[model samples]
Target: MTLRLSQLIGGQARPALSEAWLDVHEPATGTRYALCPDADGEDVAAAFEAAQAAFPAWSTLPPSERARWLDRLADALETRIDDFAAAESRDAGKPLALARDVEIPRAVANLRFFAAAATQFASESHHGQAGLNYTLRQPLGVVGCISPWNLPLYLFTWKIAPALAAGNCVIGKPSEVTPVTAWMLGELAREIGFPSGVLNIVQGLGPKVGQAIVDHPGIKAISFTGSTAVGTRIATSCAGNLKKVSLELGGKNATIVFADAPRTQLFETLLRSAFQNSGQICLCGSRLLIERSAYAEVRDELVARAKKLHVGDPLDAGNQQGALVSKAHHEKVMGHIDLARAEGGKLLCGGNAVQPPGRCEGGWFIAPTIIEGLGPYTRTNSEEIFGPVLTLQAFDDEDEALALANATPYGLAASLWTSDLRRAHRLAGRIDAGIVWINTWLERDLRTPFGGMKQSGLGREGGQEALRFFTETKNVCLNLG
Candidate 1:
């Protein structure tokens, strides 16, 4: 099917007036399968204008009514789970299984979770000796949500659901590279009778539409997810107006495997963590810090497992891995591998970009890569490569492991593999990351605050943190005469 995607403005689908279009390709086949609006600042200004106009009605609607709309949106998305998964896999170059089971379901859950959260939204109250103090949480007017290409609809809804639930009109823009599922969302919202301008989408490159969003005076808060460099740009841009901004940015997360850890379980889980979605996720562990005692044993097993992974068509059930999101990204990942080799890292397995036979000849496929012998501060080890590339380093003890894990400027996430419960808690607490997983990776709770420390990101999202970010707090005190 030849797909032509459009922008959503005032709950309607319209082609961008920018007169430019981006070809949307299926990375699995390296085929141009669709076209998406290459929107510009004009589209962004229109979206903001619509959202700004809709803010009063949408934000003042009874929370219960808003909750119902959200519930309907969830139901609509749930019913089309297969459709979304298929589209998302093609757009993002992720495995069909991952999309069907993890990404799409989480997108559904985001809507339902926020729908429920809206009904029971709370405020703190304090009873003092002479007066009563009450805190009020009210929606910020028009807010902007910009999501990355990695997870598309999953993270797109993660930001949008809460903004709408908090009674804020939203101007949302999905990554131009993976706008398929988000376009579907725009369709569903209009069909489900969401109020006009409640949720608007503007499709474009970051420098254009994204910059417009940052500069817009009417948008009160902006939630963004992407690279640390881009996040820094957003912070600087939003600083002039002092707009509320929340960023979920880059990471060079670590997986610490202790000697006492279950060898089999660690290897199996580590494979998924290192190569899942081709390691495009911000939370994926690109650095492995193995205890010296079990370093050799674990390294050999992990390399063997990486060799067995099937890399081919995304729609193929037998293929365990899919294509990279784009040819540019594929080259970037390959460049990182070359840089790793130059830095004196040993390429243990799978560093070449492959041209799989038949339909995927031109597809962007990189074998699951493993590197060793690089120092903690090496460019390949410290930078956010954001690919299926992992660097291995051995640590002598817990303190050494901690040092290696936190050495990078990023403090996004970390995974610890240890049978020792005390060490898990001790090390987890001491780790600089905002999210730490013990014996597991990518295990998420929607209610917990999710974001990184240091350069990884600023602020948090998920559950009440999302609602809180989209709204303003006002304290009202009653004095007794």
Candidate 2:
């Protein structure tokens, strides 16, 4: 039975404005499992209307009241953790453990952290010789939030939680490719008795619904997570309206390994960093920079490790990696591998897409791939392949390593592995990325600023930064006698 998905207007799941439906395929097995509305501007306008209606009251509530609702949402999500994890794994072709252990948990944490932040939401007051100045952090009216297919609910909540915590009503659009879990969120929202229009979920093609959200003047602010090209368009649109925008876009991130780093830990970390979630994550270390002293060893070991990853159904306990999200995306990733060869890079290992024996034979699966002998500025090295593919390069010294790492147009995130405390701290500062992990990758803290620099993205999001982005500040001054 194919499940039907609808646009979540106000607090309920209503039929889309049109009867046209898009088939939702289960990425793990390449089977049609559901249908989502092929929503249009009418659906978007309806959602915007709901958000505008709910904005006045929702935005004026005491921060603590919003905090309580956030907590309630978190509690509800926790109760459905297993279900969400399974749905996410099946929906996105992520290994079930990865979904259960990382993606879903982080989403729960995002909600909880933002809920606490709402309780602690504070304004600023300055006392001066002449007068007193007070700054108010208040919500914009109705806001638009668009998240990509990659992280689905994890990032969907990341944008909306803070927007809601800041007291804004949100009209959210989750990618049509992976809309299941977000629709699930809409179902949960109704159960929780959430205020109507506070957080409406719209599922559709980005061109249709996403464009409508961006074009709608009623939406005062927009927070989007996706490719740089789309983000650029959003930025231009928002600029025309003088609307606030926070974009977390693409990344061609790097993993830097110094010879001084422990070899054992480095190998394991690199495997997960490069191949985890089939490299669908924007933060995945797609470019690897190794010290010349250890380049050969790291490259050889990475190939051997890549061979060991089992690509199959996400639900299988034995499989560490799963299929790409769709056949179209699978071909796109495979094409990059061919592009690497055409550009004269040597394929270290794993270039061809595979049909893992049994159920996964029907799915869209690509083996983890590594390409070497490419220059720093080569397209394969600089572009975000955004699949289970990596480009390996060698560097002679710290200066050379930094140059190679920063060669790409992106400056999202990177990982550094070295034993020297001084060198670790030094390289951290030199790396142009927003988040640099010394001897680690993907370690996150809710309170720290998170986002990219340069073409990677604009503005930061996380903890106070997220709350700040979703809100506006008004300063008032009074003269003293």
lDDT (Cα, 0-100) at 77 in candidate 1: 95
User: Can you list the residue pairs that collide in candidate 1?
Assistant: none
lDDT of all predictions: 0.93, 0.90
Across residues 1-481, which tens digit of lDDT does each residue of candidate 2 receive? 8989877898888877888899999877889999998988999899988989998899889889999998999899999999999999988999999989889989999999999999987888998655999999889888899999999999999999999999999999999999999999999989989888898988889999999999998898889999999999999988997988999999999899999997657889899899889999999999999999998888888899899888888888999999899989998998889999999999887898888777778899898888889998778888888999988899999999899889989999999999898988998999999999988888888899999999988999998998888888999999876
lDDT of 1 by residue, 94-189 (tens): 899999999999999999999999999999998866489889999999999999999999999999999999999999999988999999999988
**RMSD of model 1 against the true structure:** 1.0
Candidate 2, superposed: residue stretches over 4 Å from native: none
Identify the leading candidate in terms of lDDT. 1
Summing lDDT over every window of 10 consecutive residues in candidate 2, give the lowest-scoring window.
353-362
lDDT of 1 at 313: 84
